[model samples]
Target: MLRKIAGIIFVAGEEGVTLNELAALLNLSPTEIKPMIEEVQQTLKDHPLSPIDLVQFGERFLYVTQADLDPLIKNFAQSPLQQKLSRPAIETLAIVAYRQPITRMTIDEIRGVSSQAMLQKLVSRDLIKEVGKLEAPGRPILYGVTDYFLNYFALSSLEDLPPIEDLALNSQTASEELFSLKRWEINLFDQEE
Candidate 1:
């Protein structure tokens, strides 16, 4: 029973499981759930080969991969032969990374196109995920970069990303230069001729 509870928590990921919620789900009391959680924590501590830990975040309990294995996981996630992000996917990732907790509609607004496919690709790649929903009218889903994003980029935190102001300035300069090109308006149909 304890192991089953622990497995449920492990599968919950960052969302976590509250004691009350677990108790209700398992048809047990809060008191009964507490000891089982402690036992699971102890088991995790005693098992050297186990790469997961039971952690408490506020009122919620989560099973997260041990932090010490981040480097190994990062390496595995970034192998060259593994899947790579396309230009649009990379751009979408950058937007989500910077303007985190943003809605898909906002992402589309910034990119000047529907980002549904790109967002789906990023989510499938585990670089971004649906964090929560906005409290507004439609209650749109909010997207955010995952810990894997930091690991893949070798960033200690989001603070380590280059300044947004610098990025904006560089982008503006690059766009101006691109627009100044004499052949910028070249017709695609000419190539087919």
Candidate 2:
């Protein structure tokens, strides 16, 4: 019972909570807590308001907002109001969305100003996050749009962005390009069509 309550609090109070933190709060080793939570997960497997589930990231465990919870689990789903972005944050977001996993240096080069401060703000808001580090000197961190960003933008996927090729092509040219690419890949002598 206490584990369940502590788990709920750990998830509700922050964007994410590591397993070490959860163990400390529950007065158990992470090893013990792991299986306990798995059991708890099973109990709530059929629950309606219990849409919240544990997210495992490497060795860490955190409670993340699950979009599936929605109107059914209103109380848990009702996130504290999100912070609004300044104009600069919005612009940076656009660049990352279109060219994701982009390094901070590249973002600054494109925007003409260092974006450290704005990037921090966006990270805090959970709209953008460190996807991974670039395999370059100093292993600079790469930023990318989050699932939350896609949800906010109402996009099915990044590919849904208006194709740049479409913008540059007239109808005839666009049709010709598609036909050429299709024929170029198709094998004329293949047994199957």
Candidate 3:
């Protein structure tokens, strides 16, 4: 039962699993779930070879890789180049960070290009994730920065991000200028051809 509970929490990922939710899923009461979680935690603690640990956040429990294994994991998980975010990924991240709980359609509109691959990369990196779904139309998934994002950037909260007005003004002005220049160059090239 403990192993099954741990497996459910592991598969839950960043979303986490609440005590009540787990109890309902496992066909047990919340009282029964608590001891199972403790048993799981004790089992993992006793087994130093286990790579994962169970943690509670609010009313939820999550399985996270043991912090002691960071160095070993980093050594094997990423190459030097892969450690850095690509330009498009950074841009997508910035957009999500500023305009959180936003949908892919909104991100594409802001970027003026498809950001599907970048979004997937960010999700895989645990930088951003699906926070919820929009109510309109097909109910597109809404993306938001993760707790890992805050920790990685050393931000206390989303409010710690630089004021969005300044960023928006600068970004909009620069993109408009770049777009006009690109359009002019394309027209000139077409005329020459």
Query: Residue by residue across 1-193, what tens digits does model 1's lDDT show?
Result: 9878987897888899999999999999999999999999999978989998899999999987789998987886665325555666677777787789999999899889999998887787667899999999989999998887776667899898776666557766633432333312222223224
Give RMSD (Å) of candidate 2 vs. truth: 19.0
In candidate 1, stretches whose alpha carbon ends up further than 4 angstroms from where it belongs are: 1-81, 168-193
Q: What is the TM-score of each candidate against the true structure?
A: 0.46, 0.43, 0.46
Which residue pairs does candidate 2 place in steric collision? none
Q: What overall lDDT goes with each candidate model?
A: 0.78, 0.66, 0.79
lDDT (Cα, tens digit) per residue for candidate 3, span 5-49 = 988998999999999999999999999999999999888878969
C-alpha positional error of residue 110 in candidate 1 after TM-score superposition, expressed in Å:
0.6
Leading candidate by lDDT: 3
- Which candidate, 1 or 2, has the higher TM-score? 1
Q: Tens digits of per-residue lDDT for model 2 on 1-193?
A: 5466445547555555566777787788988777776775565555677756666666665665466756656753333223345567666766787779899899999889999987887786667899999888899999998786666556889897656487347456633443333322312123122
For candidate 3, give the lDDT. Answer: 0.79
Report lDDT (Cα) of residue 18, candidate 1.
Answer: 97
* Candidate 2 lowest-lDDT run of ten: 183-192
Q: Show how many residue pairs clash in every candidate, following the order shown.
A: 0, 0, 0
